[model samples]
Target: MNNEVNLETYEEKKLRLIAILQQHSAPEIRLAKNTSNLFRDRKNISGPGLNVKSFNRVIRIVPEEGFAEVEGMTPYVDLVEECLKYNVMPPVVPQLKSITIGGAVTGIGIESSSFKYGLVHETLQEMDILLADGSSLTCSPHNEHKRLFFGFPNSYGTLGYALKLKIRVVPVKPFVHLTHIRHRDAISYFADLDNHCKQHIDFIDGTIFGPGEYYLTVGKFTESAPYTSDYTYKNIYYRSIRERESDYLHVGDYIWRWDTDWFWCSEYFLGQNPIVRRLLGPKRLNSVTYTKLMHLNRKYNLTHYFNTLLGYHSEAVIQDVEIPLKHCPEYLDFYFNTIKFTPVWVCPIRPLNKNARFPLYPLDPETLYVNFGFWNVIKSRKQTEPGYYNRMVEKKVRDLDGMKSLYSDAYYSAEQFWEIYNQEEYFKLKNRYDPRGRFKDLYAKCVQHG
Candidate 1:
């Protein structure tokens, strides 16, 4: 509904998926333009490479009003640029610009600004979905398709495939104020977030940079000020090309700052092939060899530090488990002591009020969700290897009755997956809304498998 029907496949899998959908469903399905480009064959990389390639596409449908109806497949990077051209932006935007809107809605999505605006799904006005019967329906809070709208976020693809979405957008300035502050521990991070949320700051999040080095980055928009041609570089000390003469820059734009350059960088990152990196730049190589051995494609790079760090040796198996805000500390201890992996990325997400009504995880009223981005470094050794650390990591997660995130194929088994989210009520809703079971896909198979 946004502008085009965007869908695509990586390598033969994409074709396989498309074939599967065409075979299982009606042929009248329209393949919208602007499909995903990330579906390159996983096993066909020319040289040492990342193992996975993922993609999100944008399908658009112009409404009677000026608003654009978007598909879940819509990529976040493009959406920000498209919306900004019209002076509007989604309330919640992911830090990794390449994340798909659909990916965020179906999975437990988060971003730096979540403290104020919540996840991307919270900003939706309506969703155009393809039901199991191959029919299309628009779902929203005010309409009859309300049940689908409510359950669709964490349901993965079991409920339905999003055709288009009628979403709310907000106006944004052209610049950003990105300030990096050093913190001692998690205590300072939370306190700073609390203080920043009360102000006009647009976004905030921090990284636990090793033992004592913590970087808390915050962003906000301000009025245009006078420019200083000869600038002394301070916080952003990493890398940059020599500045050209007469170029004015906005602090707020950051990555969304340039669409084409961002896309090229994203494409290179996701390519994951060492040869590609060699072709692009040797600087892309990680100093850590194990991380270099990961063969992880660019899409997974968008994941948090904890997941990527361990993913070097182990395929990441994350479970977006929730504990009430009060219990977050307890859960953190349970998680940290239980796993051997160093540097776990814990995202403390604040879910919408309605999501709280379900009480899926053992949530408290002040329930701030602590998302477990559990990392498992893939090892070349067999499963029987005694020293293998991945097994230990998996065992710890299994011990905790955490809700497994239903995003990538690397997640747990179907039984294990559902046990995390308890899809029985969702099944009942499925029966009520789509008795024919037309929405069946790998996601449906996993969620509903006996």
Candidate 2:
């Protein structure tokens, strides 16, 4: 047996594996690090068009000058820890605690403050890739190899493997001030968001539990207090205690920021008694369901953790679509009418930075993002039957022309993915970097057969 072990990096491994497949007869092979499980269980309810069957095997990160050179497999939770030592933080982060950087990049990311910061791809400065030809290149807008920059944002792995990414980071802050304001409806909540935009909140995200009720949550650095609250703020007085908590759980990595961040939900629900908490789990609940049951009660924590490693397992057929700023009303009507069989939770987030290098959903400078996620016990519903939800979403997104959140392995056609980015340039770049069709399987279903 020839024994020349391949010492290629994780990003290069895909190309190496592809080459091996072309030459060898083996049908099953193992990878170094695998995260396909995260996607395997998730059913695509709508947009970001994905129905992933597997993920890359390994995720690695190499620290570089002013940035961390991350492999496509690095998990976000791990990357946050690595960046903490440098007092820097990734700009755009997904809401989940375990998502990978590659997943976020491919799916495109939006979080609490995407309105101000933009998506994860917005923070990317440069990327090193292994193309179909097994050649490596570093790409950036300012560099000679610029095509990769255009393709990296939403291409998933269709263009090439992102071997080394130099993403921008900001100084770590001690705390964030979270403001929660309840609204009676989408009209009232969105109006409030526009009114509050002048304060320049660090991040803005909120949810509507029912048709007439909403909650607007905003985040900002501690020092930049935009408003005063009546609640007693702890940790600020005890520096040592705060420091200890920081070491154990980095606040930046957690979506709520700090332990106190739990106050908004907990205070609203009254407390985390086991009985109430159990009710918080999967149910025949919709966004409106939460509101109708808890009407203006924002005091309970939605601590969705299964007691064991699986955490509190919950299921929701989420639907997300990007609409032009002026079309929010039209989109909302379409979304509301389609979900007769399930409950729906609506989330409207602002796109990362309004000003970005690439094409994200174009929003009216004043438009807020609108996301609708549902929750239910999958084992209890008939709609959960295979291919039903997928077919429904495919039809809705295509007819509505709204952008989908590409996080879950939701089914989406390659045509939808291409349409999201508006095609031509993406394919041109693909032809330039991977003319051999080595990354053919990575194409959106539409692109694959077209």
lDDT of 1 by residue, 166-276 (tens): 776766666655566665665565556556656777766544434444455566765553552211111121212111212223633453332222212233244344455
Q: After superposition, how far is residue 243 of candidate 1 from its true place, in Å?
A: 20
| Every candidate's lDDT | 0.48, 0.50
Q: What TM-score does prediction 2 earn? A: 0.64
Score every model by TM-score. Answer: 0.64, 0.64
Model 1 segments beyond 4 Å from truth?
1-68, 225-252, 255-278, 281-324, 327-347, 354-365, 372-404, 409-419, 438-450
In candidate 1, where is summed lDDT lowest over 10 consecutive residues? 230-239
- N/CA/C clash count, model 1: 31
